[model samples]
Target: MRFIDSHCHLDFDELADNLTKYMSDALASGITQFVVPGISLAQSKSLLAFSQKHPSCHISFGLHPYFLTAHSRDEMALLADLAEQNSEQLVAIGECGIDSQCDDLELQQALFKSHIVLANRLGLPMIVHHRQSHHLIAQAFKQTPPQFGGVIHAFSGSLQQAQYYLKLGFKLGLGGTITYPRAKKTREVVSRLPLSSFVLETDAPSMPVFGFQGQINVPVRLIDIFAQVCQLRNESEDEIAQALYATSCRVFSI
Candidate 1:
């Protein structure tokens, strides 16, 4: 079945330099679409250029928490402007959310809240990124729920957390994390969750699946991730593939 990588970093030089080749690889593997989230304003500029050139690539504009220090107030204003100016080109508002591992949870929260507001105002969804901060993200949502809920990028958590996001209208991104034997909880969550609540992603050049640890992840590996997902659930491979493709389209309005 055809698939969409809910998140990828094609703007990163490693992927962008050989984009045509990798896009070919992804297409060959049945992955026809990709969603690229913005981390830094600088990188986002390049992402926009790439999206313009490649019709299969979709994008969002927001700041990533890990690089919080680089995002100034002016940069944030500019981020909003970018989202607005490119509203026609954008599918979502992020790659932005809380990462408990990062310093200054308060700053991250503020920026994330701003992204939520920006997304709401722009009438688009968001691509949320989280690490050990489901509570924090849920808390943020309590304050202002997503007007158009989006995808939780690279989701790995308990069924409760997965349910929480799905209740708020977000889809959980199933990535290489599920390929690991050690990820029992997440795999179980995947098995138990509704088939429609899930979407596929590789988080390429990072989050390499099972046997390929330490190697750069690529879009083509979505097939392998899809394989692992099929093993976790009760659905047939073709059934799961159709459901995933349809749900991904619903998520990003693809």
Candidate 2:
């Protein structure tokens, strides 16, 4: 079964070194495509360089809520320019969204809005990052629905929230979160979610699978996540794989 890691941080130093080795292993393990998201303008530059080096790696440009202070108006403008300049190279408009845990909620909301607007203008999808702020994201969707749709990466939200995003034309990104036994709610949601509403991701160097928690995440682990997904759902391996592959392709316009 072929797969795509809908989210990963291949530009991070930990993964960047010997990236070729990791990419080789991931390809061997059946993960054929990857989407690397940007949190800062600098990271986006590095990500673009990496994407240029690797044909299978696609990129998304956006400012993460956690790094809100790191970038200013100029950087935001730079991101928009980069998106416009590299329209064909970009797959989405984010890794951007509200994180309730962060300070300056108002600022985060404004930044997120800009990202959504840019995405809509660019006619590209987005890769949203949500943590304790589904209501804010839902509210934004109500105000201005995604023009090209998007994905809620590393989603561990309730089925109700999943349905809300699905209603807004967003796909749920399933990753290592489903591998943990304590994630009963998310696992159950995954079990029943429509295949079309789901996409696979590893969030490499971050959301490691249950047993490999301390280890740095790599795209090759997409296979193990897929194993857990298979256990939770009724679909056959080939069916699940094909659906996920098509969903990623459709959402990102790859």
Each prediction's whole-model lDDT (CA): 0.89, 0.89
TM-score of 2: 0.97
Clashes of each: 0, 0
Provide the global lDDT of candidate 2 against the true structure.
Answer: 0.89
Off by over 4 Å in 1: none
lDDT of 1 by residue, 1-254 (tens): 79999998877777767878999999988899999889978777777778888889999888999887844557888989888888998888888999999989998998898999999999888899999998899899999878899999999999998898888889999999999999999999999989999999998878999999888788999999999999988989999999999998988888
Candidate 2 Cα outliers beyond 4 Å, as residue runs = none
User: Candidate 2's residue-wise lDDT over 25-112, tens digit each?
Assistant: 9999888899999898888877777887888989989898888884555788899998899888898998899999888888888788
Residue pairs with clashing backbones, model 1: none
True-structure Cα RMSD, model 1: 1.1
lDDT of 1 at 143: 96
